[model samples]
Target: MAIDLAPISLPATADAEQFKDFGREILGVNPGGMSEEQMKEVHDLLHKYSVLLFRDVDVTPEQQYNLTKSFDPSSENHGHGNDFSKTPGRKLFELNAIPGVPQVKLIGNGTVYNHEGLSEAVLKHPSHTTFHKTHVSAEDTAKGITRFQRWHMDAALYDLNPPRVTTLYAKVVPQGPHQTVRYDDGTGDELEVPLAATAFVSGKTMFDILSSENKSVAVRGRVKYSPHPYAWMATAHALSTGLGIVSEGLEMPDDELPLWDEDKIKVYPMTWKNPVTGELHFQVHPCGVRELFVDPLPAVASREGALYPDGAHLTNLMYKMQRPAIAPSLVYPLDWRENDLILFHNRGLLHSVVGELKKDQIRAFHQCNLAASDEPAGPTPEDVRKYA
Candidate 1:
C-alpha cells in the first residue's frame, strides 16, 4: 500500500509574484518519515521546482540526514566532507557536528550551550565583510543595509561528487527589520530582504535568459574547479557582491593546498541537466572554478559571432553570464521561520546567505547534504547540437 500526501502549493508572499516559475511549498508531508511513494514525489517536486519548503515541522538531526540521504541512497559522505579537523584552514564552512549525528551540522550565529555535546559553542555566521573585498560600512549596516555573503551551490568541488540536494532546517529564526542588499558592483542593484534569508536563483532561468551566442558558449563550456577549493580560497577575497573571487593572484598555490591528488580534482560541465526535468541548468560555482574550457561550435552551427575563450577570461565571463539571473526580479529570498525545512536541488540552483545578525540574536539551523555517488550529467550530444 502507498501513502497519499497533500499537494504542494506556491509561495503566497507578494515577492513570489516576481518569479512565476520557481518554488513550491509542500503542505502536509513530514519528510522525516515519508513512505517510498511519498519520497519519490518529493524527489520529483524538488527537481521540477528547484526548491521545496516544508513549514512548521519537527525533525531530529538524524532524521534530517536520512531525508537528505534518501535523495541519493548510495551517498554517505557529507557534501563538504564530514570531517574538517584534518583541513586546518577551511574557512568556507563552519560546521559544528551534532554529537551523535555527525552527518547533520548545527550552523548559525551566537552561543549555543549543551545542546549537542557542544558545551559552549559560540558560532560565527559567515559574513560578507570577511569574504568580500568591499562591504557596507558599520554605519551603513546600522541603517539596515547588508550584502549577500557568497553565491554558490552546495558542492565540495573536490574529491567528493557534488550533492544532489541540500536540506536546511531552521530551528531559531532571529527577527529584525528587513534590510537592503546592495550589489555594489557599479550596477546599483538592491533587494530588500528579510534578515538572514537565503536567496536563490533558478539555474534553468539562467540558461533560458541567455542570448543564443551565450547559450552556445554555455553548453560547450566546462569548469575546472580547484583541488581542495575551500583551502585554496582561504586567503582570497570575493568580489563585492560575492558573485566570485577577484583574480588578484592571491589564491593559495597548489603546493600549499592539502596534498590533493590530480585524479580527485573535479571538472564539471558549465551546465548540468536536471535528472527529472531534462532541463539544462547553467550551474557553475564561480567562486570555486579555476578554469573554463569551451568546445568549438558544432559543424553546422554559426561561429561568425561566437566568443572565443581562454584562461584569462574565466571569472569575468562566468560573472557576466550568471549575474542576470540573480536580479531582484528573478531571485527568491526565503524568509525562514522556526521549524521551516527547505530542501533545494543543489545542482539546479544558486543560493546566497543574505543580511547580518547581531551578537545577541541566536539563529540555529541543521543543514545536511550528502556528496552524491556520481557527477552531474552535462548537455547531451543532442543538446549541444541544438544550442551550438
Candidate 2:
C-alpha cells in the first residue's frame, strides 16, 4: 500500500502551479522572529523543496542567527567575524556564554568585507602555488566546462558530522551578463538571470534517476572520500567544488593531510532512505572521494566490510554523478539577487558555485551551518568517531 503521508499545509506561495517561483520564496515570513508553528512549516517545506530562497529582504546578522537557532537550537555557531554588535543585548560574544541563541557564523575575508585586505593576504597564501593549478585562468576561461562542479554534501570531507542546514545571506551579489539555467531536466522551466548562480541537485532526485542495476550498485557501493584538509578555504582546497570567494584562511597542518588510500579514507553509503521524508537520499562527496569501490561496502562500524566496487562499477557511478546528463534537469542554479537569503537543506542537495569570478568581481555571503547531524542518507563512515 502506498504510504499515506498527508501533505503538510503550505504557505500561500506553495500552490502547485506556483512552482515557477519555487526557488525564489517559500512564502515570506519575518526571519528575525519566528513562531514555533512557523518554524515547523519551514522545516517541512525545506524537505519538500531542496532550496528555499528569500530575496530582497532586510535582516541583521543576529536576527538571522536567532532564526536559524529556532530550527536547531542546539546548533553550535561556527560564526567567525568581527561584526560585534555593540548594543547591550544585541552584542554577540562567541567566547563564553549564551545558550539557546543560535550562533551566527560570520565567515569573512571575501571582497564583501575586505577585498583589499584579502587580495594581499591571498597573494601570500601558503597554497599560492597550489591554488593556481586548480584555477580556471583568464586565457582558458572561455573553454569547456568553465563552471564544472564535482558537487558535494556540505562539510562532507570533514571528520565531523556534516551540517543539516546551510543558510547563506547574500552580502554582495554581483551583476553581470545573464545566462539561462535549467531548473530541472528540460521538462520544467529555465531561469535566466545575471551574476554567478549556485547550482543544486537533489540526492533524492539523483537516486530516482538511477538504473536498477546502478541502483543496486549504489545501494551496495562504497566510496571513500579523502576531504582535503584545507577544505574550509575555497581557493586553497584541492578539489574543484569551489565555495565562491572565501578569504585566505588557515592552512592544514602537515599532519592533517588525507591519506591517499582506503585505510585512511572516510567511507559513505552511495544510497539510503531519508528518515525525515522517507525519500531515498545519497551521500556522495565526489570531490572528496579518493578511492571508488563497487559492490559490498565497508562494514558499518567495524562489523567487517562488504563488497567494494570494481573498476567498471566505479567508472559508471562517477560518470552518472559527474556528467549528470542522464538526469539533465537535476541542475537548478539559484539565480541570486542583491539580498537573497538562501536556506537550503545541504543533505538533500549537491551544490557548487557556478561561473568563474571575473578579475574585479567579489561575491560574498554571510553563511551558517546548523543542526550537525549524525544521520546519513545512506551509509555511515568507517571510523564513526570522525562524525557527530
Candidate 3:
C-alpha cells in the first residue's frame, strides 16, 4: 500500500535547528512559551520524538489545551485528573469535574478496584495507612495497585479513525520522588519482538487479531470495560502465563498466571505504518510479547504435545532469524522528571515504562493515542536504519 507521507512542515517562525537537538537529548523541545517560533518547533519536535517534555512553562490548563491545538486541532479530553484533595492548583485535564464524584489521585499508593472504581474503605483511610499498613500486605497491594500503572497506548484499543494526538499536562508533581518513564519506537532505538510471536500468544495472527471485524469473537459477547478494543487483547496477553500474571480474575487458575521473564522476552514489535506520514515504526509496550511472533513452551508439558500447535512454534522460530534483519537495538529508554510533557509516535516506536521507581515516590502522566489507520506491514532493514 502507498503510505501517507503528508509533510507537516515546521512553521515559519520555528527554529528547526534548536529543536533538532531535542531529538538527541529528551523527547520534548523547549518551546519556552507561546512564541510562534517556539510553537512551531514544538510541533516539529512532536513528530520527531513522538513524546515532548517542557519544564516550568507555567501555562494555564486552557493555554495548555490551546498549545496542543498547534499539532492536533481536534484533541479531546482524556486520562486521570489531578488529585484535588492533595493539591488544589493541580488539574491534570481541563474537563469539568463532577461535584459528588470523589477526587482522583495519581499517586501509586491507592487501591484500584476493577473497572475504575475505588474501594470506599480504602478511600476513607490514607494511602499509607490503608495500603501500607492494614487492609492487605503492602507487597501484595503494591503489585495489584500498579497493574493499572501502565495502561496501553491510548489509541491501541480503539477502532475509531485514529486520533491525531494525545496531550498530558502535569500540574502537581510531588517533591523528590515520582518520575514518568517513556520509550519511542520511531527513533530506531525500539526493541523488536517478531510478529509471529504476537500471533502465537494471541492464538491468532496479529493482523487478524487487531482487526475491528474480529472484536466480537475476541471479546466473547461481554461488554468491554474500556473503549479501546485492543485493551482486551493487551490485558489477556499481560495476564497469560508466558507473559506474566498480575492478579487473578474469578475464573483464572494459579498456574495459568502470567510471569515476567525479562531476559527471555525483553520486547514486543508491533508493525505500525503511519498513513499520514508513510513512516514505519516497530512498537513495543508492556503487554506480553515473549518472543517476536513465537510461543515459549510452558514449564509443564501437555499430553497434546505443546500448548500451541507446531505451526505456531515454527513461525516463532522463523521470526527469530528475521530479528537481526530489523536490528533489535533500535529501541531507546526515556528518563523521567518532575514536570515533563513527552509525546511519542506510538506507531513508530514500541515504548514501555521501566518499573524502576520506589513505592513512596510518584510518577504521574496521561496519554492518548494519535488516531490513524495504517495497517502494520512487516518491518524492513531500511525502515530501521532511517530512524537509527
Candidate 4:
C-alpha cells in the first residue's frame, strides 16, 4: 500500500517574524524586520511547502552568513568563490575548469578521478585535489568542450553525527536553460514497494544473519578450513549471491549491466527515516545503491542461464518487485532567472539538474548545509543510553 503524506498545517499563532528567524537560522537568508506574526506565517509556510524561493534580494557574503546563522551557526559555503575570503572560519567549496578542456570547469568533485591537461596523471589521481585546478570559458573551442557531469549525494562517505543541509544560491545565469529539478521523497507517488518492504527484508534476512543462534560452527574436515567457523558460510554466500562478505564487491557480466540508453532501468523506493523528525522519506538517488537483491534459487536451477545466472536472477527479481510507484510526482520544471535563490530540504528531497544548457552559457550558484539540532524530549536518558 502507498503511504500518504499529510500536508503540514500551521498553527494560529504562526507569524512572519518567526519565519524570518527560522529562515535566517536554517537558510542564512534574512528578511529584515518581519513581525512576530509574520514570522509565524513564514514558518508555517516553510514546513508546508518544504521549499522557499527568494527573488531580487541581492545580499552580500557577510549578509548571507548572518542570515544562515539564524538557522545553523555553522553554515558552510558550497560554490567556487573568493567572495567571502575575508571571513575566516567560513567553509567554502571552490570550483574550477578541467585542464585541456578549456570550455568546461569542475563542479562539485566526488569519488571519480580528477584529471589535468588530458593526461593519464590526472586520470589516476583522486578527484578532490586541495587547490583550484583552472578556469576556462566555453568559447575556448581549440579544445573540445563537454558538459560537467556528476551524480552523488552531498556527503555520504563521511560518518558525521548529523548530515549537513545543502544550499545552492545562483550568482550568474547565462542565456540558456540551466536549471535544477527536485523530487519530494515524502510524496506517495515517489515511492515503490512501500515502507513495509524494507521492514520485511530487514526483519527476515538481516536480523536472522546477526542472531547468535544462527551463527555457523566450524567444520573440521579434509580441506583444513580456518578456525573462524563463519568464514566458509560467509564466502559461500558471497560467491553464490555475489554480495559482501565484509565489504561490497561487484561481479556483474558486461551485457547484463544497465545501459545508458534512453530506456534506463526503473528506479526503486530507497527508504530513509529522518533522524530529527522521525518521518520516513522515500529516496531514489543512484549513489549508494548499485543494484537490487533478487531470488537466486529459481535461476540457479536452470542449466543454461546468462553469465552469472544467480546474480542476474536476483537483480532482475528485485528490480521488478520494487519498480517506482510514482515516477514524476515531485518533478518541477526549472525557470532560470537572475537573482533567484531557491532553498529545499535535501534530506527529504531528491533533486536533479535537467535543463540542457550550452557550454558557453555559465550557471553559477552557491550552496550551504544546515546542521542538526538536539533531539526533542520524549524518551528517557536510560532509553537513549541503551542505543548509545
The candidate that wins on TM-score is 1
In Å, residue 75's CA in model 2 sits off its true spot by 2.8
Runs of candidate 1 with Cα error greater than 4 angstroms are 1-18, 309-316
Candidate 1: give its CA RMSD in angstroms: 2.6
lDDT of each: 0.85, 0.49, 0.31, 0.29
lDDT of 4 by residue, 1-388 (tens): 2112222122232333222212212233344443455445444444334455565556443444444444445533332122323322122223443343221223322222323332321111111111112222335312322111112233222112122234345555546222221122233322111100100011111111222211110000001111211211222212111111112332233344323232222222233334444433333222233344321223224334322333331222222112231133212323445555555544444443332233344445444443333211222323222211
What's the C-alpha lDDT at position 250 in model 2?
A: 40
Clashing pairs in 1: none
Candidate 3 accuracy as TM-score: 0.42
- Please give the distance, in angstroms, between residue 282's alpha carbon in candidate 1 and its true position after superposition: 0.5
TM-score for candidate 2, please give it.
Answer: 0.63
Give the worst 10-residue stretch by lDDT in candidate 3. 194-203
Q: What TM-score would each prediction reach against the true structure?
A: 0.94, 0.63, 0.42, 0.40
Model 4 spans with C-alpha error above 4 angstroms:
1-44, 74-153, 161-164, 177-278, 290-326, 371-388
Q: Arrange candidates by lDDT, highest first: which order?
A: 1, 2, 3, 4
Best by lDDT: 1
User: lDDT value for candidate 4?
Assistant: 0.29
Which ranges of candidate 3 are over 4 A from the true structure? Answer: 1-32, 35-37, 75-152, 170-270, 274-278, 283-331, 356-360, 364-388
